[model samples]
Target: MEKMTLPDWMKEAPTAVCPASSGKERKGFLDRSLRNFASVLKRAFASGKTKDGPMQNLEPRAKLAGFFLLILAAALFESWIFILALLVMTVCLSAMTKAGAAPLLVRALPAIVFTAVMAAPAVFSFVTPGAPLAGVGGLTITAEGVSTALFFVLRVSAIAALAALLVLTTAEADFFRGLGRLLPGFFSAALFFTFKYCLILVKTAEGAALARKSRTIDSRGVKEAQRWFASRAAFILKKSLNTAEEVSMAMVSRGFEGRVATAPAGPLGFAEYLWLGASSFFFFLSFGF
Candidate 1:
């Protein structure tokens, strides 16, 4: 290959110049934060794709009720086997619903790891009483304590997986509508608006970051970046408040009352009843184990 020649300006430039301080640019805190937030938000919203899957055929209310019952059972159970069973059930359900396992695992791993970290101290004899298994300086790891910690971690993971499955399978509008039926109108409306505005804020922050990046020529120090991030956060807050007001006015213009009104959903089919019955039976069986 022929050698490429540098321009006079490039040849004269310092070779040791930091990429950020040089003409070449690097993404700053705001840029990175916004990009990451946007990606997560996108994945979360995108997961609600109701295709021709098992969950899509079920009535929203039935799905909501069955999930809650299963989650309640998971919460009440103490056995590691029971918790593992619930986790397996969640994975199976996600598969039936055609929700990708990778995405579900990605979402659940953080919560699972965090729960383990929080439960770590419980394994020590000083925190939980039990026969000693292993010991370090001034501390003993006990068998009972390890068992308790494992149970806690498994329970948390099971619950998180189930919750992720529900979100992945259900559409946003249908999910919110189900909530409106089960909850007070004001609470449901607030939740709906909160979710709506959160997406709006994410988009707004992303746009702001892109705008800043386009205008920026040289990178600033960490302190300067921190100040900018703080100011950007304040601006996003203000914009959110203003947008909320506008949305409220728009709702008023459209004859919306203080309550959210959802159209009546059709009655549950026989398949739904069967699923619900199976869910209830499993929940009851959990109490025995």
Candidate 2:
């Protein structure tokens, strides 16, 4: 049998030269990417059996209700002081949860930064008319604009921190169960499955990237790399569809009927009642003050 050989034109083609990256550089890039991905996964799925975390012992429904109440307060208030107070409460509660402030802040940093960036434009007099605080040519920073931006940032930060704290302390299943109680049956199931699949997709992408990095020995041109990535993305999309179908079939086989049913919530304790009352009072107070 004759062995396969390159065509005459391909055999005669000139080898293209590509800029070479050091193995160390490639390894460093891969490590940083993987570490970031891992951190996101860790933060998203954080749930521990802490002995005395602030949110650890609360019923899921109670925690969910409290979170929404505080979030509503945060949203409705325009006062920077109130927003700061909420931020402090969130930080203090998170500390009591024993989930390490550093990790929580790190995980929430992206959202915080994004919110700040999005709100930064509002600080200019052009976007928000008010008394000028400072100016460079026609671009003036107004006092009212500054206050609005600060309030926006603080409100967003508080809400994000509260959400992170809740998710970190509460088990994912319990959180979903609590959410299921509030939402319609089909919507609850969809939300749960959507979030579940999103994580799976992230994991799948990470694995694919690592595999590609392991096999890659030489640096390629930007065009080649882009093409490869596009192909890989298409492959992942196809794979995800197949996986989703399989999951749906498996769930149906196990008696899933587009509804997520969780165990009935138990009676609220004294502590839960107190927490609810305090949250309600604060929420209402935000309106008056």
On lDDT, the candidate that comes out on top is 1
Position 99, candidate 1: lDDT: 80
Off by over 4 Å in 1: 1-7, 10-28
Give the Cα-based TM-score of candidate 2 against the true structure: 0.78
lDDT of 1 at 86: 84
Off by over 4 Å in 2: 1-23, 27-35, 46-51, 257-259
Candidate 1 residue lDDT tens string, 1-289: 9999978987785753544345544656665666777998887777566666888677888888888988888988867788898899889878877886776788799999999999999999889999999988879999999999998989999999988888878888878877877777788888987887778888888887767666665676788777878998999989988887898899999998776666777888998898789778868978888
Worst 10 residues of 1 by lDDT: 16-25
Worst 10 residues of 2 by lDDT: 15-24
**Predicted candidate 2 versus true structure: per-residue lDDT over 1-289, tens digit per residue:** 9999888978774543321233244434445666687776655655544336657778778878888898888888877788789888878777777866876797578889999999999989989999989987779999999988887888889888877777667877777777877766678778877877877777777787767666666666677667867887898899889998999899999998876666676899987898788888779988976
lDDT for 74 (candidate 1):
92
Model 2 residue 159 CA deviation (Å) reads 2.1
Each model's lDDT comes to 0.82, 0.77
